[model samples]
Target: MIDVGLLLTMIVAVGVPSLVARWWPLTTFGEPVGFLDVAIWPAMVGLGVGRLVAVALDGPSSLGSLSDLLIIRSGVEFWPGVAAAMLAAAWSAHRSGVASFDRLADLVPLALIGYAGYEATCLVRDGCYGPETSLGIRPPGTSTTMLPVGILAAIAVVVGAVVLHRQLGRRASWAVVMGGLTVVAGVRSLAAIWLPHIGDGLTRQHWSSIAVLLATVPALTAGVLGGHPATRERQLLDR
Candidate 1:
């Protein structure tokens, strides 16, 4: 039987971001860019690439058949998906004649909120259980009391989204993008420590997060030193 709940979850994962990105008033160099028009490209490409990456990481046994591979209700790796989506967004922005970095910065808030929405779905999904603890809720069909990490993560990211949104009113600079990403990566690294099955010491994700955190510093500096205007909207707003 088709898992309707999972299907809905997937829809929200893709739809919420796309809708937000679409309606989002993304401006670059004092001009409006129709990110709303190209939102679906990134969403679809990210989902496809993320699913493929997950299957590859899981090995051949997880592949099963071509039909099975097409089933995307489960088995997605987060970082890979995010990377693919970013690449897609960059390409889309370029094709639309908008500078990529500004658009990406504008996209950060939507990404955070979208992640929160995805995590909300995890509250009911079969997996994403956190480490067992007294301060946790036992998900359906599971005896162990697992932390409500999904909801907590959702709340956390929602807060982040609000902060970033307020920081960037109608336009975005590369500095904002790098800073937001750094914060988010750090948060993810910290949160992953409490995930079930995480072993002692730094894992690949931790290393990746650290690398991202470090890399952003120079990028942020460059962005700031370059004297890029945070918002370039003319005093007279577009009608």
Candidate 2:
């Protein structure tokens, strides 16, 4: 079977910028970047980082031999890819003379939706799953199942993307949109605790989600206090 998770990531990696290039409102930063920088660069960097982190998580065994690093099949983790993409966007923006945060803000919508799409693949693959429940839906031939964690995550990301996309152009604000993204991470983490298949202790995803949530708290607070860009612009216009 085709690796649905990897397939979705590739789709999002390519599809988002293709759409942005044509219809996206031109931003001071994004306006300068060609599709290769925005889409291709991030995807390539993300894939490398995703593999690196997965190997790191594999402990001494993965680090024992250089050959272990070449096992690309085992390095297909999701959150690492997202982290790499974020960093890659910032680096690319810096190299291209665009504001890092501005470029990040522009990409947030697609990133969130991409994340959600990635989560949806769990439905088709034996990927990360939640704790088994009496109410859970099982795949064919399986006697046990868990809560639809992936489906829930997908819903959260899609909704968050829609909320942020409304602020495209001059109305975009990192505080508002990224705050929403952080909330999704925190929520998915909270939900994951009840999942039966997460194995023992806090997994990498849990730690990353918590880290993201903690990091985003200040931004969310500041955004709520300072108000969204749209509101500020409207206030200025009123004056």
lDDT of 2 by residue, 1-239 (tens): 57665666557545654565565543646345554445667877787777777877775567667787756666555577767877888887789798777778777766665556666767555654666788876754667776777778777777777777675654445764565668567776786676554468887767777887888888777766775677788899999
lDDT of 1 at 15: 72
By summed lDDT, the worst window of 10 consecutive residues in model 1 runs over 228-237
Q: Assess the local accuracy of residue 163 in candidate 1 as a C-alpha lDDT between 0 and 100.
A: 69
The Cα local distance difference test for each model comes to 0.71, 0.68
Q: TM-score per candidate, in order? A: 0.74, 0.75
Pairs clashing within candidate 2:
130-195, 130-196, 131-195, 131-196
Q: Model 1 over residues 1-239: C-alpha lDDT tens digits?
A: 87877877767765776666555555553565443345567877888888888788776676767876788865666667778888998887787688787778777877776777778897657655778888778877888988877778778877777766666743336677876776667667767777655567786666777777788778766755655243333423442
Candidate 2 worst ten-residue window by lDDT: 28-37
What are the per-model C-alpha RMSD values against the true structure?
A: 5.6, 4.0
- Candidate 2 residue-wise lDDT at 184: 69
Report the C-alpha displacement of residue 141, candidate 1, in angstroms.
2.3
